[model samples]
Target chain A: MIEEVFAVGTSRIHRVDPRHRVVFAAVFSVQTAIGKEPAALILALAAALVLVLAARLDARRVLQRSVPVLAFLMLLWLVLPWTVPGRPWLTTGPLSASMEGVRLSWQISLKSISILLALMALTATMTAATLGHALHHLGVPEKIVSLLMITYRYLFVIEAEFTRLWRAAKVRGFRPRTNLHSYRTYAYLVGMLFVRASDRAERVYAAMRCRGFKGKFYTLAVFPAGRDTVWFSLGMSGLAIAMAAAEWTATV
Target chain B: MDRTDPIIELKGVSFAYPGGPQVIRHLDFALHKRDRIGLVAPNGSGKTTLLHLILGLLKPSEGEVRLFGRSMRGEKDFVLLRTKIGLLFQDADDQLFNPTVIEDVAFGPLNTGKTREEALAISRDTLHRLGLSGFEDRITHKLSGGEKQMVAMATIVALQPEALLLDEPTVGLDEKTHKRLIALLAELALPCVIISHAFDFLSATTDRILTMENGRIVLDEEMRVHIHEHAHKLGSKPHRHV
Candidate 1:
């Protein structure tokens, strides 16, 4: 019941090693951070776009996910320039958006979008588990890896339970009008869920023991790129050339 | 039955929650190396508790649990004995905390100190055997229920345990998957104990039937006798293993 609600669509990106895309995404994120040139930023943005297209991700869906991140960045963009006034780009006689401040905010937004896009492409084609394994293979500790594993494994279960509770709310006339009193509304449900989860944890622990679990957590290692380290390195540097160009432009 | 040489021997095993009433009371059973047993009970009857006793995760409130004829008197014995037991819990999510099918399948062997290649080989062999070759890279949480169970079983298979303990092995499965599971269990050469409520499945896959009532083994018999004496079974308040 935890696997899926449907069939995963077929695509080339889907067939690639999960680590390949995640590493590329992460590398791109680092490049965006270090590079200040418009060329590097633009190239980073281009790389992210290519991934989205290659993954066959729909723009609308991507935008829907990007909206919150985008909105958060925009909020920062609006607030930072206005509050941190410097030598006036626009001001209320005292606290004004400086020229450099405005430019910095724009740069921040652009950089964020680039980073978010890279992550989006990575997550779009690769499921959460694959990404976790990739990170684990790249030398992430088992404790953290297992936490991510458990989170990915149980996320749907929790979501399903949430959906059920949501439906229950709907059935019991739980429409929250703009002026409705609903702060402590689902708190009881949350408490009940905690109790249920604890009980489940106890049962799960019992089950684990029954199957011979000790304190030691074990797992298989499938780091495909590690075996092909030289090849991956060459490819990364090839892309870094464009990143270098972008960084050079940002400073100007 | 040579009680002295039992693979898993339990004697007068009793357990009471720390702050609650006595849960498991005066239990006794001994499993042979290749014996296939089933544990059936209702929702709170200490079936899980009993299993934990054998696993050494929980010490009995009274009496003792023995593994390979050695009493698990301390934490070390429990640790040493756990390697021999392969447990597949009812929830695949908990048992399989690996990202992909292959990695999850390889986890047990890897922890036991198997190299990457060795782990990969065992993972591949088990997945192929379980009919999950195409799913090596697939997200574990995205697999179908039946497929998840298959992968979960593969984890045990890769672990190479002497005995397998499966809790509700095929619950939440479709009828087709259920039949397939019973056949798979029956074909597995290793000794396995299945804790399930599915009477037909238990009868089909296991050589022995066991029921826990009030934290004790109220019924332990061959499958044939179990069905034959179904009507005269005592106080139908089904045992709760959980």
Candidate 2:
């Protein structure tokens, strides 16, 4: 699911060094999260939208893939207006909605969407391996980087195993229902998956040791920070500075 | 580097898990330069365990493992030896942990202290040799079973090991890829000890076939003899296996 949602393509954003992209995304996300000015938030959203367009990403697909997150944002919109105390804007029977609460919800949703769009435009343009290598070069801990890379590599294998087991159960006439037997079977299924994964882990470790794996994972992927990458990062930084300036002026 | 020196030797090797039955007992095996040996055994017959012992991945309870005239007694010893002897695991997934094919193939050379560019050059050469020149950027998980197996071999072969220890190298491969693998192994001419249940495949690629049963080497003979005599089980009609 993550793989398809973050599908890569050959675009200008894709050509930028993953390390630079990661940094740009991080800085942009931080600014978007803390900026309170509506104009600045809209500018952040516009920047994210520009990135999305420059990358040639499909808007419909991105929005469709982001449904779950959008649903959570919708829930915030539904509850915040009633719970936060402010000037009442609308009322329905015993419940009253507040203008401040609605504005707060709008800020959160827009900021989150902007951050998500920025991530899709930057980090998601590269393969997970590239991103992991970029993170390593950016001073991420070796252990955490390895964990991320290995998890990305094996997630599909685990999913395949799960599908295989699920099929086996289906072949044996198993059906999902709210019963003790169904619950027990599902529990057993999850338990067996972990047991098998652990067993495979031991064998894989032995294989790795046999091949001279000495605690650290070495990578050959190089994300050279070239002219294009520098220019792209500078452009994003300029936009981010403009957003921050707008926020400060609004506060002043 | 004497011609008579064994690439690998295991003397009086015996191993078992804690509180478990001995998986390999008093096993003695040796491979010389240019030796091509095949080990065939049923499940739970210590084939993989013996490979591990030879590589020092699993230390024997009672034995000495020698690699390239050096005794493997500690982690440092094994680390040095592994660069000379590559072991291909039964499952390609187990052996391949990198996100892309090139990285997985380059991992061994990189870990053995090659510079990134050198490792990549070696990996690319190995992949080209394995008929996978354009697969460097392909996601390892998304590869076909046969492609994965070939890539796993490429990983080890990139290290340019003097010897190879393969465990069920052709388990999930199609016939065409399987034949290609047999051809590739034959051409490499490295001293190799292969553990596989595919008797026909072993016959095609190996010089001598050894049968292990109950933790001991029970049969050792030329591949032709092994194939001709035991082509079929009792009460089974004999047919041409073309």
**Cα lDDT listed for each candidate:** 0.72, 0.86
| After superposition, candidate 2 runs with Cα above 4 Å error | A225-227, B1-3, B220-242
The TM-score of predicted model 1 comes to 0.78
Indicate which candidate wins on lDDT. Answer: 2
Report the poorest 10 consecutive residues by lDDT, candidate 2 chain A: A1-10
Highest TM-score among the candidates is held by which one? 2
Question: Could you report the DockQ of all the candidates, in the order they appear?
Answer: 0.35, 0.75
Candidate 2 residue lDDT tens string, B1-242: 56687989888889998899999989888899978988877789899888888887787999889888778898788887787888898889998988899999988888889999999899999999888999999999999999999999999898898999999998888777887898898889888989877778887888888888668876654435344545456537533242
Worst 10 residues of 1 chain A by lDDT: A1-10
Model 2 vs. true fold: TM: 0.93
TM-score of chain B of each: 0.86, 0.90
DockQ of 1: 0.35
